[model samples]
Target: MKRRDCLKAGLTLPLLPLVQKAAAATGPRPAAGLTRVRPGAAGWPGTSDWDQLSRAVGGRLSVPVSPFLGDAATRSEALAQLRNPFFIGDQPALTQTSGYHGAWLSRPSARVVSAANSADVAAAVNFARRHRLRLVVKGGGHSYHGTSCAPDSLLVWTRAMNQVELHDAFVAQGAAAGTAAQPAVSVGAGAMWIDAYNAVTTHGGRYVQGGGCTSVGVTGLVTGGGFGSFSKAFGTAAASLIEAEVVTADGRVRVVNADQEPDLFWALKGGCAGSFGVVTRMTLRTHALPDTFGGVSLKVRADSDESWHALVVETLRFCRDTLCNPHWGEQLRFGDERTLGVSMVFQGLSQDAAAAAWGPFVAWLAARPQYTLLDPLQALALPARHMWDADFFRRHAPHLIAEDTRPDAPRMRMLWKGDQSQVGWYLHGYASAWMPSGLLDDAQREAAATAICAAAAHMPVELHCNKGLFGAPADALAASRATATHPAVLDAFALALIGNAGGPAYAGSGGTVDEADAREGAARVQRAYQQLRTLLPAAPTYVSECDYFQRDWQQSFWGPNYPRLLAAKRRYDPEGLFVIHHGVGSEDWSADGFERRR
Candidate 1:
């Protein structure tokens, strides 16, 4: 078989390519490579193969099996864990459970080798390579593109490898000469952000730049250039990375760091996980914990179309400029029916500084500029009473910084549901993109305006940015000396203005819609937002947050870095054992995996 052909010059944007139905890959004449595997292909660890794999991994394999149905006790426990579609990272969620954000986008292969350590992982890789089977690496199991798990592949489940270690000084050899080695945290790939957070706090004052959600896996977040409230203050999660222990395609455990296997080191950070190799553990730089402040939850309610658009634009601006102190962080959420909610926090900002920072933003929200000269009756933005009482906001806002995932914390969701009390709903889908800091050009804004107005219903959207991620001794927005996060991350935080965009999908009446109309609606949504992506050329969406259906995905995900990344992929994974959909070397594989792309 052959590798990806990306030598074609120039960027070609395919806004939305046709998604072909799954078919077993065949008819490939790529010399020197193994047979290409596809979804629904017939091949696997049949009973004997399963037993061998189980033995190889010391009985760590998990497969679908029937407990005598008559045994009520065993059956009851099994049903609670295995069949739930939305269970978030519970041990027995979907074979392809999307870590903490289980989207259930694809069915998973029924078999998984729950490898405990790097040696076990290496053995599994050699097994998959020997059989020419499609493989997926499930570090946190949370995959936006579903690359972490697949339907007919041998999955390396790393959920059990939850280990955390802290070091006082992590000397990075390849750091630019003047840079000093800093304290570091070494976390297992399967460990969640909370685990790392606990370790940092226990170490006394340090914190790692990572997911706001406690359950988000450190490995997955960093792989896609992790951004959070603290990111602007520190840098991206990827940038903070100092070292990693990886299991490569050749079944060797390699220590990858700036001085070790530098190219692989570069590819791992922001180049994304699963595309290079399985990262068993990661060591990242940590920052001293600073004083943190929280802002009140401000709700902006708008009853009309003009009001919603203006509110979203203004709120984003507030986050971008008005309150954009490097030490401060906030979340801007847009809910259905033109409603906007904001939750903010700050660290190391004194009360007086905090008040000064919130001053202009609050005043602007309380008194909005009028958009028209004619309509005297319509209040400019949200009516006074409808806006969350500003005074109340000033008094009751939170002091917490990172997400609180305790049982009663608002962000906590019980991944394991024992009864009807758990929340349940269908997620239509979630799509996001990065917007460079700037107003949408007229045409782009108009398109969003038109789409939102015609949309069947209100869409939940959010605009998030880490003002701190853009800071530095030099220019925070400039490329970092530490890790390989895309430089586009430093561009103004303009979120692709997704129409009907982000908090959560609004579920409607229980009636089902015509499948054909649903498809049409999806197409329309894709076109409307895809156009918006075109306007913001400077800023690319975070690879982890955005959908993979954009035009020229490789360029959009990684600009000038694509060529270099492709070269590295060719060098490290020669047979292309690691492939992320639309990732570095993925151009070589067809979307269906049935044919290699030219």
Candidate 2:
């Protein structure tokens, strides 16, 4: 059934009376100040109150069932399910990442409102606010910083709302009369990138800018300045946003766009997630699909430090002169083991063209006797329409994809084999810094290469070329500039990301935590990132994938846009009803977002 049809059907249910009663019982609204109530607190809701909430949301409210808990057989099931992102997302409490050292561990909320529509979300918001309860939001449950789950809090779970619809020429609800309609797609907050790709690209023969990870939540990605494998070609996912349907802190359903609630709309694009409001659904502009999409992979080991430094210098020069354009994206890895790894993607290019593009660099490496080729340099191209087609991979290259093995799972639901390591991994430390495009200039290339080698001396460092917009098209840069993302990205040639993590380690999932190793790894990752920071001291970071303990997050994540975002926060959610770690206006509250400071 269509999403609109489902919403219409849901509205017919008797859900209004409970909402009214909950508001009425709260009497005069309390001042926007206090510590939220947990279970057994003086202001905590009773059984009857919980039952009323359940009824209001059409019996969708329930105690979250944690896979980490239960008996031996259940524990075994949990271990197996950790490998499947689909199974993990289906659970009320499980996050795609288990946790980060000394940061947070994934914990289930006391209760969850498995919302199916905007009305249900509003009901849950009203209940949480009226009862002075701590609230959490979860969709794809992929938060690396552990923002999606909290102990003893109420969860607004949108996992049941996954829906994807395409449009030929869609206009925002409040767009001007003469506003030209554009191709777009409307995605439920719970929908993953794979779902959007399937609907828009695989079936509709179009493209929607989204995250590189197919299982990432659409809403979370766009709201947090998302990047994809082809971002250099299409810009950021946030820049493609047309409109959104959001549930605000006051329980009002708002349709925000450039013409309506413009401030909120701007904030919604590239602003931190779970801060402004609860996004029920969003519409993103789509683009024509390129005929072919492809990738290049090569791994080489350097025999000596001297050779490695030369390799780094040559690689940077090659990138600046040839691959630093819209056609190239993805990473170039520098490891502590004196190795250089290349895993990059290209759009609008054929196998031959892609091979030729890397020909000079390949030949340069071949001439260096001190460098040994660890893997055969390969360039592969395929029909762009089949890029996310699970059946295509299953039939042609089964090793490239991992299917959802459950009997009831959809055939198209699969995870890239490369992404399997991150399924339930626990982060040690992660840090990213935007490297200025000038660093690749003839005069600065040597300095940049030196910093890279020094950084890798501590740990492996990857440069995600697509995350920066230095070499992007003008229109793409303009759209990104208009959003709330840090301006540093606009002038950056690449984002240097360094991190380390351990295997799956949830509390009761039978996975053991290696505290000593985690601490040591965290230190190493910090040292590696600091080495790059020496080159670009004031570089800004991508909010979604930054350090857990970032000190100057306001400047690091949003830069000059923080004050504006804070204003939007005050205007739309004055009471701080929605809060996440390091999110806008979070400084006014405690770390866990339970107690208001000022």
Candidate 3:
């Protein structure tokens, strides 16, 4: 089955009907005493009416859609001219455009506006408030559970809000302040990591809170717990936050930070996903930039069978265990490749010593005589750059790139889904894919090894240790912060290249892995996370991994901070006129009814 088919199967869970009924009972009930707030419909409006909404919002919204999402002649045209709005239908291509490699576009109920400025976001929020409508906020559209954008729900796109503000040595100022009085940055929610990186780096090698993927949005990434390469050396992205500027559901603009709206400030840091409000900008602490060493590429073959897998798996496990050691600054990416190479970067250690320290892993791969490591730095002399501003995205995209592209392989088909596991050890289960059948176990593994060798023939598998992937130290960030409630959350990215997946455009790559193959690949990943949990026994928890897993809004992402968030919501949005998809504040029921009336 294709990945979409498996995901579609997920919609058919036995308890789906019961879940829907239960949701209807307590889901987004009509606000008490508020005639304006009506029960929202379950799904989005039809696709044909999308343009009417685009025209309705008019210049108030900023999105990529060119008035063609609803009237395009072909799928490509529709996708090319797509932008988000409440009445707009879901764009399948844009669904999976999130930070996590695993998370992909499933289907949304409706589209929302992508803001270019704070006023634009304010307009959307206020509009929702006036209409008693539900809203969803998207920054980089990278949430694992597709929480950022909702179908039928009024969506707020922060992409147009991408702006980087650089200040003096101490702090980088953004247009949107976390609070009215505090000195913070006011960033457009849509800005990507690379944007921030360039802004900071251009101004005297300064550093700000960001993550590994250059394309991830600052708003959603920080709110959902930003993790990146510099994290272990620095801290989780949220810890560096000084303030946030947000547009409340009731269309009120508030600044949240340590001093002003302190409770809301606490909520905004890690606790605020799409709930509290639309984060238009943030003021983040700045760090002096440091000279670092790293690389991004793919490694395929190793001398022996056990050595290649062991080198990849064990090296990853070791890196995870020793992340806080201070001497190592690393990120990893391993897939259907051999001898995955680590893009090793070290700041605390000397250059010569860092290379020597990484020598053991290198020697291990070298022992695999059959393994042919294609070091990009050695071959093409490409220097390792940080994930934030690297030139990888434009080159590889949808799926192929310099890191793992095969020239003669079949076209690649990729499906990405995200999960967080609490496992700490790494393990392998080669027997599962061919299990039950066990027909060509030996021959298959060998062929697999050959393929691995072939892929690595061009470039080595570079371990891009996604910085800040793990939630911040719970003790340091506090439960009041968003990530504190959801500790050990790691972004698991699953990517594959297959034939005929991208239609006829780039089908000549010759590398193709279909749905069944992808499932097997995912199973391999599951086993890896599960076994790693045994070793470290502290892997991140993925909401989709378990059947009973439900994103309770307050608990899974916010934890014990729900009461405080609810209190803030009540104070800011008394009428409950503005609600959001997922579990946001929809379940709260104060005695006098929902709070905040505009």
What's the CA RMSD for each of the models? Answer: 9.7, 8.6, 11.9
Question: On residues 114-210, what C-alpha lDDT tens digit does candidate 2 reach at each position?
Answer: 9999999999999999998888899998888888988989999998788998999999997999999999999999999889999999999999999
In terms of TM-score, how similar is model 3 to the real structure? 0.59
Q: Supply the global lDDT for candidate 1.
A: 0.55
How does each model score on TM-score? 0.74, 0.94, 0.59
- Tens digit of lDDT per residue, candidate 3, span 218-282? 77767755555555455657777776788876666777666567777776666544667778888
- Across 471-555, the per-residue lDDT of candidate 1 in tens digits comes to 3334334424344554555654433333211111111212233445445544555554544445443345567656546556665
Better of 1 and 3 by lDDT: 1
| RMSD score of candidate 1 (Å) | 9.7
How far out, in Å, is residue 212 in model 1? 1.3
Question: Of 2 and 3, which scores higher on TM-score?
Answer: 2
Candidate number achieving the greatest lDDT relative to the actual structure: 2
Q: Clashes in model 2: which pairs?
A: none
Ranking by TM-score: 2, 1, 3
lDDT assessment of candidate 2: 0.85
